[model samples]
Target: MLAEGPLEEAVEGLDVEIEWKPFELRAEPKATLRPEDPYLPEIWKRAVYPMARRLGVDITLPTVSPQPYTRLAFEGWQFAVEHGLGDAYNHRMFRAFFQESLDLGRLDVLVGLAEEIGLDGPAYRKALEDGTYYERHQDALRDAEAHRVQAVPTILVGDTRLEGVPSTAQLRKAVLDERARLAASVTVEGVVCRADGTGCA
Candidate 1:
């Protein structure tokens, strides 16, 4: 939620393409955290709230107990990507979780969110039931593992990795540096006798 807004601002008008990859902190079989747990509230008060305030973002630690496993949500993301609604789906997912406290783990809730984003509700529900995007989601997870992504908000600019929550200034600088690196690496070949030859260089 926090990273999305700053990321948009950072890449505005820049020759950059942003891809939001999936990384599950607690993928299946593993127990998820509960908002009622002391650890959650403590971390929120100590770090999350402070960071949100610094970034001028209104965020809250959700009250959902045994937080919903996100595999279903990510699978829905795969469906959204195929339908050209990836960005909208991502934003809505964040809002539904943090602001609206919607259960992303529920099929009905996910289908409703998909409909809200202009996707065919029944088609999406059927896809989820049939596990249409299950493998695709798994592929994305493997890609994240290959990249050694161990945390959320792992922003990569060129080969540089920015972990955790990053300020807009930090993102902008990384983008500019990456652009400069790409520009420097591009080599142009000079043509000889270009004026006399129809085919040259």
Candidate 2:
């Protein structure tokens, strides 16, 4: 989604509500990833590589994986999302971890990132330390568990869940299909759009 902003552009004209829920992958927060997953090579080659190329992300496999906990970043993103930083922090974090290999598990690092995005650095640090937004992170985890989201980039479009990094075209099509489905369920007026996102779509 970060690559080229395709998802954002795809839905710009749809008037659809987009909700971002950030959470860690494991069953618990602040869990560490193993040094190696044997299938990482295949996934890197099959999915991540091609998607990065197609999206022009310039994404690279980390030379030295930080294996950092994303919980702090997810909690800190509450401020970013509220402040309208426009994904700057997310992009910065992505670059830090993937390209520059910065450790995300540090408070000072995250605070600096917040400051870079024009957010209140000290205040964000205070809030993070006070656990003010931990509940929100927990809520996100609960929602993720409820959705059975076992993959990264799981997007919920109506009743359908598109897991992993889905193509921009597929994301747009899902939005249209879900919109049509919801419109058809209306009692007073039933407006059915084409399934291909063509007319009335």
Candidate 3:
């Protein structure tokens, strides 16, 4: 939901298969946050709120950070993805977390969002209660570690790794350039990096 606008446009009419791998930012398994967590203010002041404003995103960060690991929400996301409602689920969750100041780290909050997104709420509740997708969520966390993803909006086209949010034009160019490079490498048989993949770094 964060970079959906540009990313969706970037891959438009392209034969790119995007894989959404979720990851956690918390260092520990059970991480809780307070209103005065010290780091939150810095991130909001220096990065998040500014980026949101620049992107014209509607977000209202919480005064008191929720206590509980985000893995619970990620597990619910696993459920949403499996049910083919990942997009709606993700967007609503974003709105809930930021705009509505909902605690996504809470199972009840996640269940409510799932229901709002037309998913089976009770089943999702049970899944969270029983820890059904904990390991699956952990797998995604492992994949994030493998990719060295310390930030959100970490996009990869072929071998090009794009970190942070890129503008619609910038993302579109990246997608087009990558498409051209792949096509040219196969068709032209001479130019390997015609689109300056190095610049994408």
Best candidate, lDDT: 1
Q: Report the lDDT of model 2 for residue 32.
A: 58
Q: Assess the local accuracy of residue 43 in candidate 1 as a C-alpha lDDT between 0 and 100.
A: 91
Residue-level lDDT tens digits of model 1 in 32-112: 999988899999899989988888887888877789999989999999999999999999999899988888988999999
Residue 12's lDDT within candidate 2 is: 77
lDDT tens digits, residue span 32-92, model 2: 5543655656777888888888777777665444377778888898768777873787778
Which ranges of candidate 2 are over 4 A from the true structure? 1-4, 27-31, 34-42, 63-66, 187-201
| Deviation (Å) of 164 in candidate 1 | 0.9
The C-alpha TM-scores of every prediction are: 0.91, 0.80, 0.81
Model 2 clash count equals 0
Model 1 sits at a Cα RMSD from the real structure of: 5.5
Worst 10 residues of 3 by lDDT: 192-201
RMSD of candidate 2 to the truth, in angstroms, is 5.3
Local error of candidate 1 at residue 140 (angstroms): 0.4
lDDT, candidate 2, at 127: 86
Candidate 3 achieves a global lDDT of: 0.78
Weakest 10 consecutive residues of candidate 2 by summed lDDT = 186-195
